[model samples]
Target: MEHITSVHNPRIKAWKKLQRKRERDRSGLFLAEGRHLVEEALKSEVQVKVIIIEESVELPPEWQVSDVEVIEVPEKVLRELAETETPQGMTAVCERPDRHNLLLESGRFLLLDRIQDPGNLGSILRTAEAAGMTGVIFGEGCADPYNGKVVRATQGALFSMHVQQMDLEEAVDLCRENGVPIFGTSLSGSTFTAIAPQDSFALLLGNEGEGVDEALLEKADQNLYIPIYGRSDSLNVGVAAGILIYHLRGD
Candidate 1:
């Protein structure tokens, strides 16, 4: 195993840039911090390029994979690459999966439109994976799923599901081709309970503040919404997503 002692090491500098969206896009890889995320990535088919661990942290015997390089770094170097207050002492660089495959999968999907908050996007993804949804589609204006905050919030779900980004209109057209009914969430739409759960469908969720786009809403086969009986005018996008996703999954 190689050891890095300086925070200014060339590799450490490059890993720090992974914190930015453009860097991740350009490099076609993202940093997975902590033992849990790294372990999950290793278990998946996603190619693990390099694993970095703080020198003081012990390496699990299971992490002794033959093909990948393992580097032990000092606390300062680990801290520079960490996004959390308390570093987990381990991180890995993993190749981003090909998202074009997301369009070919046949199952229920959660299509997010302009979800700006990383926390909300992450939580919704976690819920979608837990609910056995096939994948997630991110439309224009949505936060990047690979962002550190979003990945951390996903709690490893990032590696478990198929996630892709594209325009809402094109996504709608794809769903039409697949014979999948597109359901949009709207305040004035039908009550969610009114729509029966199905084997395959696409649920469209909109921005936190604006709800679904008017053009997309108009194209939806059906628009459904949860009844807000209490004083609160609306639900947090994540909370609303949980309610709708599980109910629609119906299993």
Candidate 2:
């Protein structure tokens, strides 16, 4: 293992650049901070390029790292690369999984449209994974799934979930072509219970403030909404997603 004590090291500077979306996009890599995320990345198909640990921190014995490069850095250097306020001592530089070939033939999927909040996006993804949904499709204006807050909020779901970014209309068209029903959530739509549980379908959720895009809603096979019986006018997008994902998944 190599020990790097300086935050100004060339490699450290390169890794730090991943904090920005442009760098992540250009390099096709991102940082997985903390132990849980690093461990999850190692277990997933995603390729972990290198593991960086603070010299004072020890990795779990069970983690397999013989094939991966391990580097040691001082706590200050680790903090330079960490997104969290308190550094977790371990982080990994991982290649972003290729999602270009995701199949749309059959399975339960969560399609997000312009979901801006990183926390909301993360929670929705974690819920989708737990509900056994096939994957997640991110529409334009949605928070970058690789954002630090989003990644941490996922709680390791980022490694296991199949996520794709594209225009939602194209996704809707693909689902329609594949015979998968698309359900959009909206206040004007029918109650969610009105629709029968589906074996395979796509649930289209919208922004935090605005509901699903009106144009996209128009294209959906059906539109539905969770009833707001309480004084509250609406549910948080993440909360609403949890309710609808499980109901639509019917599992």
Minimum summed lDDT over a 10-residue window in model 1 is located at: 98-107
Error of 1 at 151 (Å): 0.7
Please write out the lDDT profile of model 2 over residues 156-212, one tens digit for every residue.
898889999988899999999999999999888899999888999999999988888
Q: Candidate 1: global Cα-lDDT?
A: 0.89
In model 2, the clashing pairs are none
Off by more than 4 A, model 2: none
What are the lDDT scores of the predictions, listed in order?
A: 0.89, 0.91
- Give the count of colliding residue pairs in each prediction: 0, 0
How high is the lDDT of residue 130 in model 1? 85
Instruction: Name the weakest run of 10 consecutive residues (lDDT summed) in model 2.
Output: 96-105
